[model samples]
Target: MDLSKYLGLFVSEGGEHAEQMARELLQLEGAAVAPEAIDSIFRHAHSIKGMAASMEFSEITELAHAAESLVGALRPPRAGSVPRATVDALMAAAERIAVLIRERGRGQQGEGKDLTLLLRGRAADPWSEPVAEAIPLKVEPAVSLRDRLRTVRVRGETLDELLDVAGELLLETSRLRELARQAREPLRAALDESVDRMHSRLRTLHQRVVAARLTPLSVLTDQLPRHLRDIAHQLGREVELSVAGAEVEVDRAIVDEIADALLHLLRNCIDHGIEPPAEREAAGKPRAGRLRVEARRERERLILEVADDGRGFDTKKLRAGAVRRGLLSIAAAEELSDQESLMLACLPGLSTSDRVTEISGRGVGMDAVKNAIEGLGGTLAIESTPLEGTRFVLRLPLNVALIQVLLAEVEREVIALPISKVLAAIEIPSGHGRTFEFQGDEAPVYSLGSLLEWKEIAAGSAAGRPVLVVDGGGKPVGLAVDRLVGQHEALLQPLAGPLGQFPGLSAVTLLGSGRPVFVLDVPRLLEA
Candidate 1:
């Protein structure tokens, strides 16, 4: 078997183990280091060392080997309390290892260096010198163990090819379904059932393949806490960053883009959002500031929220900054709501910081963050209060590859509407202007046929005409369709060339009959 294809799995595993070690070291900083913690850290270091050595990543293996020795020295039997100085050294070593792991993760071989001096305690220091011994592994792989091949790496392009092949298979399945529907006779029925089962199995496999391309949200946010710790110390504050739902998954492409923006947001939180320890105490808050990052699946979107318990936004300062920068007229700034003015930070070419600081001040500001998130088909919004804190929330679509689509006919053309975007389908109520009032809100209820430029040929020919009520920011509009054809699991295939520029269309799907059904872009239509 070609193990080159499996390089991604190895990288992902190594990154995960490195992150686990970082988290443990941070958590055990002041607490009595338990034997379990020591063993946990030791095992991670040992495993990483073995893996890196096998891969001939000398620098990574050396760092891991050093970490293992230190952790091993602390294991078990109240032999002696771990010296504060020793714990500090281990923490620094863990941080360096994390940086190396991240660099390797980004496809860079880390710079080589001997960290033995840093790992060793001074001769007179309380900590004992690391005991030297032969490498720990007793058995090695039977295959060629010494040769490390760097060329055996799979780029993301390989996965994209697999996805395209799956899309073609979906088109074939659609053709088979159409053929089955047109057949008549007992033999035809049996054939249709057999083909349908095959289609179902193929669909399942497609989903699994696409899902493997997803990376967890926690993976992107993993570095935040450690950064926050260092920033808190530098700024003379005490803070604890708690992250949950690190397991919520998103496409790797989206995760990579979001990680950079996440770093900036956390930096802003530490530098601007959180108050100093004394001020926090005066406000009847905990001496240590608290920052929390959470991820959760909400419908078809993955929501990531970063919140901090610190002095929140200074709305007055924000408004003043906007007016000074000439982004908003003085009069307009005066009339703006606190929330509205607070959003000015996200305006292009705007910065609230008066002077450049090492942490935050640069020409690039929240505007960059907003663009990056939106570029990923995600939205970024902020909520803050002066005395309370601030929260930046990002909502991103799960993946573009697959969606549960409800097929409906608009005039003579078939359109696939994402099931998540559809509120409900109902009969259009009788009204002039082709409009309807839903929940005391008036919205123009247009026929899907008219919307798609398909003039209705025959109205009322089909009983119980379906009108799909779709949401455009809480205001639901009815889309009258000739029929609710049925539902199917669809692999969203991108339209080719300029046809992709069509409005209100996100992608196209092939039905069981080999016919292309356009998938409605619900969000874009709502904007219209």
Candidate 2:
């Protein structure tokens, strides 16, 4: 068998196993080292070494061999169990070996760092000694982190396929429900019960498909620490990057797009916001700068924020640059908020730097970040304080492949509201007082039927508009629609030609009945 074809799988599996071993070792460190932990580490390293040897990759084999030896030394029956220092050193060695293997798999040369030094350095904990009553191993079977780590690494195409299947199931369920509704007799009505069960099962399947597409942001943050190290070295600066809420899960597709966007944002902070150590010290700031990235789920959207403890935007200097470039009127520039003014840096062809530098300020790529993010149906907001720092927050929908939509009818056409954005559905009396009490204040409810000029509502053929109470930037408003149809899991179908340019619509989907339904763009509608 051609081993090279399996190289990706080998690397991915090896990396996953190494990570699991490291986590288990970390948990066992300082505490009584469990035999299982040592065995686990040894097995992982040994397997990697064997795999590399079989593939005839000498560098990988060597690194794995070193790690395996260190781990094997810790395995029991040698008059003592592993010591904390030994375990730690072994984990570090394993990490280095894992990186080398990964780089070798990518056809890059291994770092060839010596692992013998690491092992010898940790040979003596000096405190580890046999005790009269040895620490008891828990009797209950322990769960291995390796066992917990799933074997299958799902691909993007598989997620898309599952989404498509879920949508198809939804369509079938809807069709069956429609048939049951149109049934005429008691015998037919009895058959409808089976259809209802099928519908419920389809919903469950749809939920699973959506869940499978989600991945925690931590997966993407894995490389940021190394990246920070490289950038800090390049600039002769010291940076400590902290990450929070890495466990916050988002749709994998959104995570990928956000990763690319956030990379640019982080580079901007390192390249421009943070001054070198000497410069920072001269300016009375701390020698080491701090950059923090965090992710959290807010309502139906995922929020990603990257903040740096560095020099804030200089509005006066920005205004001067704008004037020099003739991009903004002096009067307009004076009125901009610091946050708003700082956002000008994101504008196409606008850079505060007078000269293009290698680090940043080429003036060509800033707008790409904004455009790429906005293209993903996300909003980017910038926050800055004079001496505090600057933060760029991005809000993205959880998933778009298969969406739970609040199905509603406009004219005779059904529409979908990404269940994420829909705050609530309520019935409002037609033409009642335009203002209603909300949050102790009067708020005006707009009619989607009227805005889109849905013929059924305009012609007064349908009942009172169905008002959907929506939270738009903490301000709640009601959107009136023709009538509420049941919710559906639909595959998002983008609009075609000029109709796609409609300010209030994001995507469209066809119901099982083959009827076209427009998915409401909540953000765009709120903007309008």
lDDT of 1 at 195: 76
After the best TM-score superposition of candidate 1, give how far the Cα of residue 164 lies from its true spot, in angstroms.
Answer: 4.2
lDDT (0-100) at residue 347 of candidate 2? 73
Where does candidate 2 clash, by residue pair? none
Model 2: per-residue Cα lDDT over 15-126, one tens digit each:
6666656755655544455444567668887888888788777776776777777666564524343555566556666677678768867878675445545454334332
Encode model 1's per-residue lDDT on 38-74: one tens digit a residue: 7777888888888777666778888788778877766
Q: How well does candidate 2 score on lDDT at residue 369?
A: 81
Model 1 sits at a Cα RMSD from the real structure of 18.3
Angstrom error at residue 59, model 2: 61
Single out the weakest 10-residue window by summed lDDT for candidate 1: 133-142
Candidate 1's C-alpha runs over 4 A off are 1-161, 175-198, 234-237, 278-284, 319-336, 363-365, 406-416, 429-466, 472-476, 480-528
TM-score for all models, in order of appearance: 0.55, 0.63
Report the alpha-carbon TM-score of model 1 versus the true structure.
0.55
